[model samples]
Target: MPPYILPFEKPILDMEKKLEDLRAFSQAQNIDVSFEIERMQNKITEMRREIYENLGAWDKVLVARHPQRPYMLDYLAAMTTDFTELHGDRVHADDRAIIGGFGWLEGRRVMFIGTQKGRDTKSNLERNFGCAYPEGYRKALRLMKLAAKFGAPIVTLIDTPGAYPGIESEERHIAEAIAVNLRDMFRLPVPIVVVVIGEGGSGGALGIGVGDRVLILEYSYYSVISPEGCAAILWKNRSYANRAAEALKLTAPDLLKAGLVDEVLPEPPGGAHADPAAMSATLKAALLRNLEELDATPVEQLLEQRYNKFRAMGVFGEDAAPAPAASPAPAS
Candidate 1:
């Protein structure tokens, strides 16, 4: 009944509305409403299943960046018991774009690092709209190293458009900072689990994305470049972003098929924003499952596997080699 509802949520909401109307009508007429309610309930269930089962790539992107989708802080509040945030990169002012510190999830001490995008306009501006700066990446590196030293397994929630590309960030060496984090996280002597909780754009996501096990939410995306950027580069037109999105294979299922992500964590019907609590419960269970498995493995083995996991990505077979430009046909 609400305006601006996503297409995937429309059918489910429609079923609910029908059930309500049926109840109201039956109550006014003093007739049996139970049968009608049951039928509507079945339709609701069927619609939910069908919608989620056949989400297209663009629909998945919509879910991933859903305005109400559970962000990092939402997940932390729902799942963590005690959270004390640590701040500062030590060499510069604090970057609100990143939040990291120690937290207790399911009674286990874990270090959490994540990009935080605010929920509304004012807050979004304060958080740089989820774009990390050089200092933010540096702060993440500090927390990661501390977690490794303290023997706490690391959990990183990735949700960013990309790192900031402002002149200030460039002056501060954003690229170098991101590169350092990528290098350090790869060999950290501890278990690292990364969840692409939302938008995962370019190097900003990968800077802190190294993990023993990498999981992507069913609706989240991970791409070397955002669709807009890819379109501008490949088609010389920003309007081709939709086409680029289709060609880039940036959705969770696409990444899984490409061997880029280890697992896909299912979201609530519609998206995580539909039910933050339920989404958090699902993610908490997923983390616990992987942590248990990682806990049982020898630390050395875990590190080796993590390293090998990344090494195996982007491997191309002989068919991957680009063919020489086709020779022009003989002149007519």
Candidate 2:
């Protein structure tokens, strides 16, 4: 299949194609046009840099959802070694939407868990488009507990539209499953690192999102709710998703400024999809650095700091002056 192209990327791709054709023609004619081709290549680089630098929230949203973007399994394959996938929740059937197992990272044994989206239509159906059902969350929690017990650090890669909203998921108590993971993750004695590799939406992402250090990729988004869902709820139309994205402050810079994310890993020139190996290298370095720092802390201090880290999120309007004792409302 041809590579997917976003509207904003058309011009860049077109210029690149034209440059390639020019170079081919030059070679065919046995002419010396190396200088000219180099000049055009430089121009294309500058244009791409400018476009990526000034991308608006909507552009970022599209990038985050780009079909070619590397998914969880992609990262795992690129960044880890000796991965042994363990399956089934034990209480229910295994969910393909979320997968977890033990892996070797920089010579350290760690538990790797993430929401898995398929690369094609059939696999996407099987994975429910990366939206986890209740069992998925249960399985994640189970792996996390095992990690904690065995003295393995936990690494969670979040990329999901949201938790599955199907009636069957609700009937199975999806919310409760996610909530349990949230509560248990905080208390784990081992170090935990989380990265938002792509679309981090709502409780689906949060189901495995809690960690000592939370990182987001440059173009990835982490939000309580997806922009399209928010648009539908507020304006009764999904087309307003772009505006909704702006309003939600869900971008990496926004979240970093708000203290929701500890770090933002830079992506390749265009985005992660443009160069998965480069993106994976950056992610691996950041993970190893953070994990090293986290490993040096005492378990007591680690747990306490992790607790305070999450507790510090959100804005609390400065304590309002206590209202003057309700002025004798009883007289009425």
Candidate 3:
């Protein structure tokens, strides 16, 4: 029902509809097209593989921001148990943009943090379209501290256009909140995992994004700024965002190759929106694998690893470390 569905999605949906109709026809008329159904199913699988294999960076960005793409709440509903939501920054009113809670995922006690955009018109307005204010970032900092204090591993879901840049947010010290999160995140003692489930825009995304390991969904993007903002600043033309997106190196594959993210979890064919359950399953497995590796690490080691992971990214000039050689060393 969302507007951004790719052209390929239509035929896939049409084939599925036909299959459903055939099932109904068989029940009603006592006719069997079992062989025909199997053939059509194979065709669907082939089409899906082709479509998923060739998604461009821009297409991936659009898929990441798809209106129907599953958000943090969807993941929580599907994967977590006994979710106890925590609220407020203690110094200010609670922010809905960042949702924090203690929850159990696959029998592991963990703290969940994420930016939440509203799904519909009214909820979107209520959530400020996932744009965090200073209070939201501050609240996230508080939750991260709680997770560390309780020794619970943290799982953060990033999905936002950016932090709110309105007058009220400035009054509350937006930059200060984000800076504090980044500064404190490096010192936290537990395993921290960040997943860019959708748009990872600027400090807003990074406010809760610092972690021991970062994973991006197949179609998601992690960028220092939005493509439109980058275009306006660089060329003074907003229409050049597509070009900026290409040059920004913001897609999952680009970031992976650049060594900015730890892993890229594949999404379902036609993007996560086309098959949320499958996407969630894939993400859960990735999360579990990362958590398993991070769980046994001591708090001090976790902090050190996280600090080094971020500190090593984007160093410039003579201070930058040499990249690994094209061919790996021969086994001893």
The candidate scoring highest on TM-score is 2
lDDT of each: 0.88, 0.94, 0.88
lDDT for 293 in candidate 1 is 88
Candidate 1, 1-332: lDDT as tens digits: 13447766876877788888898999999999797789888878778778878887667777777777889999999999889999999999799998899999878989999999988889999999899899999999999999989989999999999999899999999999999998888778888999999999889999889899999999899988988898899999988887888898999988998889989998876578767889999999999899888989888898889889988877655756555566666778
| Candidate 2 TM-score, true structure as reference | 0.95
TM-score of each: 0.89, 0.95, 0.89
Residue lDDT tens for model 3, 226-276: 888989999899888888899899999999999999899988767788788
Error of 3 at 103 (Å): 0.3
Considering every candidate listed, which one attains the maximal lDDT?
2
Q: In model 2, what lDDT does residue 285 have?
A: 95
Q: After superposition, how far is residue 57 of candidate 1 from its true place, in Å?
A: 1.0
For model 3, where is the 10-residue window of minimal lDDT?
1-10
Q: Give the TM-score of candidate 3.
A: 0.89
lDDT of 1 at 313: 77
Between which residue pairs do clashes occur in model 2?
none
Candidate 3, superposed: residue stretches over 4 Å from native? 1-4, 14-31, 319-332
Over 4 Å off, model 1: 1-4, 26-31, 317-332
lDDT of 2: 0.94
lDDT of 1 at 32: 90
